[model samples]
Target: MTPPPGPPPLPELHWLEQLIERGHPHLQAREMRRIHVPGGPSFPVHAITLGNPDPALPAVGYFGGVHGLERIGAEVVIAFLQNIVTRLAWDTGLHRLLEQVRLVFMPIVNPGGMWAATRANPRGVDLMRNAPIDARERVPYLLGGQRLSAGLPWYRGRLGDPLEAESQALCELVQAELLGRPFSIALDCHSGFGISDRLWFPFAHTREPMPHLAEVQVLKTLFDQSHSHHPYIIEPQSAQYLAHGDLWDHLYLQACENTGRTFLPLTLEMGSWLWVKKNPRQLFSRKGIFNPQIGHRQQRVLRRHLALLDFLARAASSHERWRPPSDDRAQHHAQALAQWFPT
Candidate 1:
């Protein structure tokens, strides 16, 4: 008798597992949740931590695969992790850096979606749009998140329901590993939106600038001073378009509720349009639209973003040196408001 074929495997998970094996004694991998795909085998969502574990130390988080189609995002993160692991044997500076800063990696957040080749998980919820937050201002129909049906893109989970397991797991990890610290940053990677790479901060639910706008401006200034030729368009997520149930927005708000915590959550939206423009045939393929289909381009993409990731680690570790003082906070806030909130 002929047996039914099984669902395709998740290559990202395999690659991450390999890294865990090689990073032994330096890396710590924890299973956040086990996702069972309907008619498919279950896959584990992992959170890999390294560096300082003390609550007093600053931390940075690297996340990817929020949308399963954006394989390039996950690849970029994995490449950076691999680079770090390879350097563990001889990088004294890295060991020194680890003494002061903690690092977290959840390179593949939607393993089921990656396995199923869909944006949403097997439960059909868009994890990014599955948070409890809602947009106060008008948002574009459907693109901003909709409750019409799970069949649609950007579908928020059912009203009045708790978050999906994946969403809950991510939140739990962030709250415990990041929010408790005095300073921390999160970079969630995604692609397939525009023609240029973008580094977006919170308030995707509205155009209102967040309280940390001044800090963001300072971070941008620091990034520009360091990487003069970088291509990212650093701005608020609402500057592009507002969306409902943004997980970062919810998490950032939660961080704000604490009296002295500073959490800067960023979204790395790697534009796929340029890739499609360079190779127009990519438009015909669904995966290609969200990823670099060509080999050299993929390698270039992986190589280019590693610097940004490293910069984030360095920035978090030395935040005390560069963070704006009370005397300059108002000036930065004024400039930021003028730049992003011009009426």
Candidate 2:
């Protein structure tokens, strides 16, 4: 008898497991959930955590591979994790930083989708669109998420049904590891949006600015002051398009439910169109649309985002120092409104 074949094995998953083995004594890897394909093998969803566990301390979460087609996002996160694990051997500064903040990584959130080369999970649900949210404003036909058939892209799972397993895993992880903290920042990476890289904050369901717009603005200001020449269009997700069932938006809302807690989630939308522009042949490859097809280009993409990931961790550890006092928050809000939500 022939056994049913599972999706081809995922390279990212293998590399991540290896890092976990090597990162022992410094990092902890837990299999949060396992999703079994209806007729094939199952895959594990992992949450890698390090640093202080105190809920009073700040934290940062690095997430990637929500959409299976965007393998580069997962690769970027894995590269960063590998860098940290390698440094755990003797980097005094990194070790000290780890003591002050909690850092979590879910580098490959949708392994089944990645292995199958589909944007949606094995059950045909788009994890990003599987949250329970609806747009207050008009959304693009399908890109903004839909309750249509699973055969279509950006399909939100059946209404009134529990979230897809991958979505549930992310939500549960964020609620447990992030929402209860004093402060936390989450960065979810993806690509294939435009020619310029973008850093988007929440309220993807509406154009209205989020309550923590002032805090987000200040963080952007700090980054700009330090990096000086970084190339990223920092803005709210609504500025580009509105979407229904955005997982980050859903999680941010949950964090907001806690009084006195500050949770800022950022989505890194890398611009892969330029890769296609540079190599016209990428237009013909499925991976090329959402990732850098050339070997060197892929490496460069990985290198480019490492600093940003590290910066978020550093910023989270020192958020209290950079976030303004109540007396000054109004000014920050005013500035943010003028720049991002001007009348």
Candidate 3:
């Protein structure tokens, strides 16, 4: 029997466009375009802003698909936009919350990878590992027992620099809009591994937490409160479990350090055992079919993710404070999610 086809391109694009059009009037929207690898596709990064662009109102930026095969991340982002549109149409509280803070959504960062269904760019550079950081001492483990080198799958690329066109484009966008700004939090989504859902912070080179560790802990707490089913595991910057050259490291440590702003970058790793196809090569083959069990689970997880994002956006917009920082212990233990969803 012939296998079922994977998600089509037109339906995804059409759904995104419709969501934006319907929600544009309720939120501030901008079209940011970037050229993919030279002589490649021209990708559009949509920036949606809700509420006034006030410095006091903390902003939340959501991006996904830094790697191509991680299409579930992109789907979650689109789902997020659709959920917001639906809420705006029926929920008054949601419309008011959206109008209080800005939420910038870049659904797909690596369009080239999206097309190829590969992690690296067409030129063979891993954008995640291409950040301008020293990855020589920190190597990522591949599927096999062998460790990845600089030119391999998880390669840091061309002397720890951003050589890929998509990487360069993302860096430029960060500098122009996100960096040197007063955004309190940012989330980048990805899917792989059936490990527990995790909230990863910065500093890939060392295990030390970011200077704003207390604040990050607070935010993690808030996230935990938002969901009862999917528990969130918050860890230090450099855990022994994963190593080196992550985009969050570049953003939170490098960019925020240079700009002197406290931008807490969180890497949300969605469990992939739910939606990922077993035989990835089959996805490209005509006889390949999507695993229904995984897809359904992914859809459910996507809804939970959207709800968490909405809660975070609302908390940031209102500048809600969690438990009173009476002492260092109370302050450190207080998660930001609690502030977002006060009980």
Against the reference, the lDDT scores of all candidates come to 0.92, 0.92, 0.62
State the lDDT of candidate 3 residue by residue for 210-318, as single tens digits. Answer: 5666666666666667665656666653553445556667766655565445577777776554433443444454312221134556577777677666766875675
Q: Residue 265 of candidate 2: its Cα lDDT?
A: 95
Task: Tell me the tens digit of each residue's lDDT in model 1 across 195-252.
Answer: 9999999889988899988899999999999999999999999998999999999999
Question: Candidate 2 regions off by >4 Å?
Answer: 1-8
Q: Could you tell me every candidate's TM-score relative to the true structure?
A: 0.97, 0.97, 0.77
TM-score of 2: 0.97
* Model 1 lDDT-worst window of ten: 2-11
RMSD per candidate (Å) reads 2.3, 2.3, 6.4
Candidate 1 deviates by what RMSD? 2.3
CA lDDT for candidate 3 = 0.62
